[model samples]
Target: MMSKSNKMLDVQAMDTSSNTVLSVRHLKTYFYPDDGSVRKAVDDVSFDVQRGRICCLIGESGSGKSATAMSIINLVDRPGKVTGGNVLFGGRDLLTLDTKQLRTVRGASIGMIFQEPMHSLDPVFTIGEQIVETILAHEDVPRVEAAERAVTWLKRVELPNPEAIMTAYPHELSGGMLQRAMIAIALCCGPKLLIADEPTTALDVTVQAQILRLLVRLKDEIGLSILLITHDLGVVAETADDVLVMYDGHIVERGPVEAVFDRPQHPYTKALLLTRPIIGQKLRRLPTLHEVMREVDDGEIAQPKDWSTLATTVQTDGDKGEAHSTDANGNDHDSTPILTVRHLSKYFERVHGLKGEGNVKKAVDDVSFDVHRGETVGLVGESGSGKTTTGQTVLRLHSKTAGEVLFDGIDVFALNNRKLAKLRTRMQYVFQDPYSALNPRLKIGFAIGEALLHHKLATKRDVMDKVVETLELCGMDSSCVNRYPHEFSGGQRQRIVIARAMALQPEFVVADEPVSALDVSIQAEIINLFSELQHRKNVSFLFISHDLSVVEHICSSILVMHHGRITERGTVDDVFNHPKDDYTKSLLDSIPASNPKYRKIGR
Candidate 1:
C-alpha cells in the first residue's frame, strides 16, 4: 500500500529538478466582486506535470480547476487575481515575470486550447491567418515561412485539405474542424507544455475520440506535457498518467490514475466516480454527489442503507417490464406511436460569392422514425447528422422542406397558425443550451408562467403556485421562483428549463442535448428526473444526443442518424448489444471506458 504522502504527490518529497515540466505550488486565485466579497477560486492548490506525461485535473464546475490552470500561466483576468503562487517552468518563476516576459513564455513554452474554439479563435480572421499570427508573435520568422509552417502544423494535426482549411474562416469550419484549427494554432510554435481546458466537452463522441487520439499522438511525437482540465472521469481514466481531484478550491486528492480510480482515498473522489452513469450498469436511479457525500465516513464514502434498492430494477415504471422489447417489424405494437416522422427533410440554400447562384444543402434528407408513448426514443448521431434539425422540424420550430410530421395522428406541418399554437400545448422542445433557451431578463417564475398564461392554461392568480409546484417536482426549491436565470448554476438552470417544459404538461417532448453541458453528477440527476417524470406522467420523448452511454441508460429504443438519414433503428438491447450499422458500432466504440485498465489503445 502506498503511503498518504506518496499518493498525494508531495512536491517537497519529489525530485522536481529534472522530470517536472511545470510545477505549481500553493496557488491561490481569489475573485473580488463589486459587493466586496472575496471568493477563493483556487486556494492552496499544488501539482506537478511530469515531462511528456498527461496530468488530468478532474472536478465539477466552480471547483477551481480552470482557475488553477489560468493562474499557472499568469492569465487570471481582472477582478480575479492570483493572490499567491509559484509557477516554475524551465527553472523560471512565471509569476515573477512581467507582462512582456510572460507573453514570450506563454505561446513559446506553453500553449493553451480553450473549451470553445469558436470563441477562442478570432471570428474575423481566417484559420491560416490566425496560426501564422501566433507563430509571428513568438518567433522572428518571415511571413511566407510562417504561412508554410501553419499549413504543416495543420497537416500534423491530421486535418484534411490543410491548404483549404488555412484559407477558410473559423465559421466556415465545423466544430471538430475548428477545434483542430485551434490545436494547430496552439502547437504551431512547438510549445513544450499544453493546457487543454475541456477541449472535447461540446463535441460529438466520435469527434471527441479523434481529438483525444490526436492529443496522445502529439504528446508522443513532440514530447509535450499536458495539463488536461475537465469534469469528465472517463477522459481522465482513458488518457491521464496522473490524476488531480479538485473540490471547491482545494486539491482533494492526487495520485496515479490507476491508484486514484481503483482505490480513491477522498470521499469526493469516490462520489464523483460512483455518480457517473456507466454504459452497461443500468440502475433505477443514479446516486447523486449530495447523496454520496451525505453518507461519508471519515475520508471514505459509505453507501446509504437504500443504495441496494436503487440498483434492483433496471426498468422504470414507464417501461412496464417491456424494456428493450420490440415487435417483429421493429415497431411498438402495444400502442400507436405518439410522434411519427415520415420522409422528413430540411434544406438550406447557400448563395455563394454574390453570384446569385444558390446551392441547396440537405441538412435532413428522407429521415423517418417513430416515438411510442411512455417511451424514450433516442436519436444518436454526430454533430451535423441532422438530429437537432429533425427535432425542430417536428416541433415546427423549423419549417420542413418536405415530408410529414404526425403528432397523435394530426399532421403538424399542415396546421394553420391558430391550430399550430394550440398543438404547441401538447408538444414542447427542450433546447440544447439551457441558458440561451431562457429569457435572461425574466425571473424564473415569469419565464415559466408566461407560457402557461399566454396559452390560457393557468390563471394569473394561480400561475405562481403552479410554477412553484413544477419547480419542486423537478428537484428544486419553491424559493427558486423569485430568482433570475443568471443566479443559478448550469444544472439548476437545466432543472428550471425542464420545469418550464413540464409546466405545460405536454404529452411529447423533443429534448435536444439537454444534459450535454452539465457535470456528470448533475447529468445523473437530470436523467433520473426524466425517468421519474416519464414514470409519473407516461409522456413520450424524442431524446437527441451524441452521448451513447447516456442514451443506452435512459432510452428504450434508438435510431442511428448519419448524413440526415436513419441508417438503423431498433430496441436498445439489439442496437447496443449487436449494432448492425457500421456508424453505430463506431459511435459505441468511441465512448471512453471509465476504467483505465480497459482504455482503448489507438484510433
Candidate 2:
C-alpha cells in the first residue's frame, strides 16, 4: 500500500514535474432551504485525482458522492450551493474561478459523463452532431475536423460503425450505445479529468461490465484521471485505485482501494459489505427496510465478525471474483417443489410493416423450472431475454401459449374464470418500479388493504387493522397509512407494494426485479424481508433480476435466460460454479467484483 508521505510526494511530483489533473479539498456543498437550515449535500469531503488514477466514491443513494462530483464540474443546479471547498486543477483553485472561467474549464480542461445518458443527450440532435458541437465549442476547429474527431472518439469508445452511430439520434441507439456515445462526446476534447457518475446503473450486467472495461482501457490509453461516483462496490473494486466510502454526506472512510475493501473499519462500510450479494452464499432472508432503518437509527453495524474476514478476502483487481458462502446456521431445511412449470412456451403474433407476418415470437421458449416451498428461484437474464415474460406467464398474467403451470399439483391454465380469480389470490406480483405499479391517488392503507378486501380475507371493520398489521410486517409504520406513494422514497414505496402483494397471504409471488431500482443497503433489507416472509408464510418466489450477485445469495435455484430460452438452470451452486452454456458463462463474467485483489480475468 502507498504510504501518506509517498502519496503526498507523488502528488507534488505530478503538479510540479508532470500533471496533477484535479485536487479537491474540504469540499462542503449544501442545499439551502427557504427557511434557515441547510441540507449538507457534500459535507467536508476531501479527495484528489492524480493523472491517470481512478478514484471511486462508493455509497448509498443519499450519500452525497454524486453531489461532490457535480460541484467539481460547477454543475450543481439551483438550491444547491458550493458553500465551502477548494477545487484545484493544475495547481489553480477552480472554486475561486468565475462563471466564464468555469465554462472554459468545463469540457476543455475537464469532462463529465452524466448518470443517465438517455436524458443527457438530446433526442432531436444526431449523436455525431452533438459530439461535433462539443468539440467545436471548446476547440477552434472547422465542421469537417469536428466531424472527423467525433467519429474517431466514437470508435475510441469501441462503438461499432462509428460513422453510422454518429448520424443516428440518441433514441435510435440502444441504452449501451447511447452511454458509449455520451462517453465518446466527453472524450472528444481529451480533458485531463473525467467525472463518471453511475455510468452503468441502468444497463444490463453484461453491458455494465463491457462499459467498465472500456472506461478502464480508455483511462490507461489517454492517461486521464477519473472521479467515479457510484453505489456499486463491484465497479469500484475493479477500477478504483483508491476509494472514499461516503455515508450521509460524509466521507466515513478513505484509503487505498485494497486497504479500504480488504479491511473496512467503519460500521457503515461493514454493513454495506454484508448487504451485497455474492456467489455461493445462501441467504435465509434479506433485511427489511424497517429492520435496516432501525439499525441505522440505533447506529448498529454488521452482525457477525466472520463477515469482516470475507470482506477482506474478496478479490477486487478482477471483473469476476470468487465468492465464499458463510452459513451462520448449520440447520438444513426441507426443500420440496411448490410451483412447477413444465415446458412452458409463450408466443405473440407479430405485425411487421404492411403485412401481418405469421411470426410467432416465442417469449419463454420450452422453459421448465420449479420453486421449492419457502425457497426463492432466481431468474437471471438481460432485457428482452424473456426473464420478465417467464415470471408473468408463470403467474398467468399473460396466457401461456403452450405447456403447464402447476401450483401445488393443480394446473393454473386449466382453471375457469372464477377458479382463476380464486387461484390469482394464491399468487402475487411485485413489480420493478413501485411508483408506477402503485396507484398515486390511493392512500397506503387502501392500497395494501385492497388485496385483503378483494380476496375476502377480512371484513370492512377489520380491514384497517389488517392493513396496519401488513404494513408493520413489511417494515413500515401505521403512520404511513394516509401517505401517498410519491411521498415515500423508492425503497419505501417498494415495501408498500410488497405489503400489498403479501397481504392476502399468497402461496407464491413473482418478484420481478423488486430491488433493482433500490440502493445497496435498501436492497439488503428487502432481501432479508423476503427471506423472513418466505419462512413465516411458507411462500415461494420466482425472483427475476439482471443482478446475478443478488440472485446468488437469495435464490436456491437459478435460471439463465438468453434470447427467449433457458440457457442454464440448476441449483445456485451448480450453475455459478460450473456453468455449461457459453451464455451463462458470459453472464457470470459480467458480474462486477467487489474485491479488487483478484485480477480481472474472464471466468
lDDT of 2 by residue, 153-254 (tens): 888899999988978998888889989999988888988888999998999988988898888898888787888988888888788987878877777777
159 Cα displacement, candidate 1 (Å): 1.1
* lDDT winner: 1
lDDT of 2: 0.79
Q: Across residues 100-146, which tens digit of lDDT does each residue of candidate 1 receive? A: 99999988889999999999988898999999999999999999999
Indicate which candidate wins on TM-score.
1
The local distance difference test score of each candidate is: 0.85, 0.79
